[model samples]
Target: MADYLSVSALTQYLKRKFDVDPYLGKVFLTGEISNFRLRPNAHQYFSLKDDNAKINAIMFKSSFQKLKFQPETGMKVLVTGRVSLYERTGEYQIYVDRMEPDGVGQLFEAYEQLKRKLADEGLFSRPKRPLPRFPKRIAVVTSPSGAVIRDIITTVRRRFPIAQIVLFPALVQGQEAAQDITRQIKRANQIGSFDTLIIGRGGGSIEDLWPFNEESVARAIAESQLPVISSVGHETDTTIADLVADVRAATPTAAAELAVPVLSDVLAEILKEQNRLYLATSNLVKNRQNQLNRIRQSYVFQQPQRLYEAYLQRLDTASRHLNQVMTTGVTDLEQRLQLVRQRLLAESPTRLTHDDQARVSRDTDFLNRAIQQSLQTKRQRMERAVQSLDQLSPLKIMGRGFTYTTADDEVMTSIKQLHPGTKIDLHFADGLATATVETVKPHEEE
Candidate 1:
């Protein structure tokens, strides 16, 4: 029993042995990742495995934050960390301090991931703006000493010398280059006068042009109010900035060409327009003069009175027709007046009065007959109604030997309403009598 040790004691001893070993303290391992799940704002736990075996790996949040690319399951990676044993679980694992993609394939994988993420967010799907056909002031964001700006300036000067060029110097390489490029883009916009922005650098390796691929640079280009023309690296190179910009150019010289029109071509077009205007003005003046000549040669101008000769003849014929119409209209009116006078005499007041008097006499007789018949009908109705009411009257009922009694000025309908010695009034056909109730009894009791 003295030689036996508990599981906890053995685990602790092994953990210490793994921790203090110098080779295990900083081991460089390369293997394929397995079971890797990203835990936002927390530590990552996964396994690194080769064909021979597998080892569990853990990366704390602080160390994982420094990773340049996302680590995923089945991705080959080179990790530098330490081997340590867990006392509680009795498992040996690697605590990764640093990790990176194993090869170029991994870097490309990271680029694809970012590309897909930005695409999902509609950053690449946004409508691209059209570059100004003739930019007055172009802003260039690139290395001040680079050949990119030189090519742009030379092309712009050779083509459109009157157009101004403003340079916003920025670092086009290295880690800090993305931030500087973004700042220059914003600054150029803040000035509020630049018509177009050209962002680029000379030919370089992917590492040298990585800043243009950065998310910050892409976002800045996408959000720019001014149109952006991206010309980065060689003709074959395309970056995130290029994808988001309003226009993409293979070289800086090509970008300048897109930004402004050729000075000679524009001047030639203006001269051509001027010549066309002169030709048109000459043709228009000649056409108008020819029309004036035709008008002068017309018969109306030759005779002068020919314009109103038909009107004078029309006036003479119209005057004779109007006089004849007036004579015929007067004769018709005279005949109508005589006919109306005869009709007036035929409808004189004397005849109308006799007819009106006869109508009144007949109406008076009819009214008198109607009044007599209405009075007779009302008198008959009253007699019948009086006879019916008399039949049902209390006086009439008393005359038939039936009487009613009232107690407290109300008719007594039930024997229960009266008791012995109750004062009551008896109403008969010819008189009303007063009496006191001696004995009140119902018909059943009687």
Candidate 2:
């Protein structure tokens, strides 16, 4: 069996050999391309080689189309592929899953590294802002020319023409692209008044879209006061701008769609609201009309006199209650008055006077003796009080040889108060005399 191995068996054994080898199964390769050519609608056939070695490499059409750049012969490349043997040719080649120029590959690695860093920083975890329902203006940051601006304009106008498009042209690619995009973002913020911002370009290579992945652009997007929508490259592509922006649209036109609603949809909503209002108003009016009809057809309105009849019935019941209350009260009062009359007759003043006449005579004699005794005691007390008063009287003082003298309507108690020519009235207990003060003598201190 070892000496006579069939071609199929040999190829199959080699296929298994290449498949089973851990180093060759999947590989990371860096080399210069040789004999590389892009084939139309077919897989790419090329050779990857350095100065010392060479290996056949093939990228299927699906993988080739996904490359951001076209590969050329003698170009430095980085590739990821798996080693496999061609069944018919029995030749082992690398089936490349991904390939890129080494410089671009490094940039892509940087992109991924930065992406992970930002993710860890939670810059991508923030809640996305909501686009305004009816934005007054939408700011666009991109090159003024190209399909990006055109498609955005077309979509925005077609969907909601009322919202104005404010263009802040920025370099979307190049070394200064990140700075330009950052400047435009800040400029848009300075101008204000925009409810939404769309920053991006159309489909492009990784280098072309690199500005969107730059840290400056991502920081600007994260800091935007207005809701930012990122529309960079095609549907399959993503960038740091897309992660930080409030919304991500696959295309510029999609960004426009997100920025505003369809006019007809808004019209329909307004129409629905109008209809609801009309229905509510109609129902309210109809219910009120029904209530008014019921009121007009009520018994009170049908027979106008019945309204007063209810009041009359109530008045009659009240009148009967009042009569009953008054009659009961009068009867109670009469019974009470009869009891009072009997009590008054039993205690009549004239009968009492006759019954108590002899007792009154005896009480009167005793009362007269008591009155005489009380009068004698009171008279003696009064005479004592009168004698005390007489002792304090000025007439009593005059009897004791004390007199009151006056001059110029002033009492002169001291000789120094008298003036020689002053006329005064001398008052005594029994008499008054008009006299002139002839002289005044002051006694010596000794």
Candidate 3:
């Protein structure tokens, strides 16, 4: 046991050796990532392997957060980190601080990744603000000493002299450029009164124009309150700023032209419109005068009384026709009245009353005779019914010296109703007698 070293002790010795090794302190390695999976809020653990060898690699969340493009399994990457050993697992691994796609530059890869992400978020497809036809004042964001500002001012003054130009000076290159550009955009919007915003710089290489490609600059342009016209580089160059802006111009001069219209052309157009209006008004007045003169020379205007002649004749004829219609109507009404009077005389009240009285007298005499005959028939039928009912009456049978017996106050019609020792009542023609049954007598079979 004294000669044996525990596993923990051996692991600690190896870890110290790995940590202090000069070659392993800041190693630059290029390999394909394997078994890579994202771990939220924790360190990223994966394997990096080439065709010949493999090694375990881990990147802390802080370092992983700084990576612009997402890393996946089997992707080739270049990483800068140090080799270290884990005491518990007795395994050696690389701690990565920086990583990038193997072939492409880091900045370009980051740019493409951000662009895709924002496009997926619908930022690129968002409805862009429409540029105003005429801007009263414009704010330019760029390097104060650059040729871009000079070119914009000169072009604006040449095209639209009345329009005002204000410069919000900002760094347009290097790392701070993106932040400065975003700041200027916000400041311009905050101060207000600017109709348009122009952000640009002179033509340069991709690296020089990279600030405009930054995500902050792109987002600021997209979210700007004032319509932004981006003019970065020459006609062939396009940046993220250009895509997000309301309008893209090939050059700063073009941006200025887009901001304002040409004064001379506008003035000429106004003058032309004025001439057209004057001509239209003069033609309208002359035509109206010619129409009035033609109307004055008409025969109706010269003979004013003739205008109403047809109407007057129509009225006179209408009056005569009305008088004839009224006279004929009166005559017809008088004939109707005479006819109605004759009909009334034929149906006078006295004659109608006499006829009605004669009919009533005849009806009364006939009704009296019919009533007497009905009474005689009813009396004869009632006397015959009374005689038939008297012959079938039980009282008539009893009066013929017949008798009936009852038990329990009910009349007995059969001999079986009589039983020995049962009390009974005998009904005679004019009396009822109660008696006890001594014997029951029934009819004997012959």
Best by TM-score: 3
TM-score of candidate 2 relative to the true fold: 0.49
Q: Give the alpha carbon lDDT tens digit for every residue of 218-298 in model 3.
A: 888877899999999877666788888889999999999888999999999999999999999999999999999999998
Ranking by lDDT: 1, 3, 2
Q: After superposition, how far is residue 439 of candidate 3 from its true place, in Å?
A: 5.7
Candidates arranged by TM-score, highest first: 3, 1, 2
Q: Local error of candidate 2 at 405, Å?
A: 99
* Residue 33, model 1, lDDT: 75
Over the stretch 131-207, how does candidate 2's per-residue lDDT look in tens digits?
A: 99999899999999878999999998999999999899988889999999999999999898889989989875555
- Runs off by more than 4 Å, candidate 2: 1-58, 61-105, 299-446
TM-score for each candidate, following the candidate numbering:
0.51, 0.49, 0.57
Where does candidate 1 stray beyond 4 Å? Answer: 1-137, 164-166, 186-195, 202-208, 213-227, 233-240, 313-353, 367-446
Q: For candidate 3, what is the lDDT?
A: 0.89
Per-residue CA lDDT of model 1 for 334-353, tens digit only, reads 99999999999889899889
Candidate 3 stretches greater than 4 Å from native: 1-132, 145-151, 173-175, 189-193, 201-254, 328-381, 399-401, 407-410, 419-441, 444-446
* lDDT by candidate, in order shown: 0.89, 0.87, 0.89
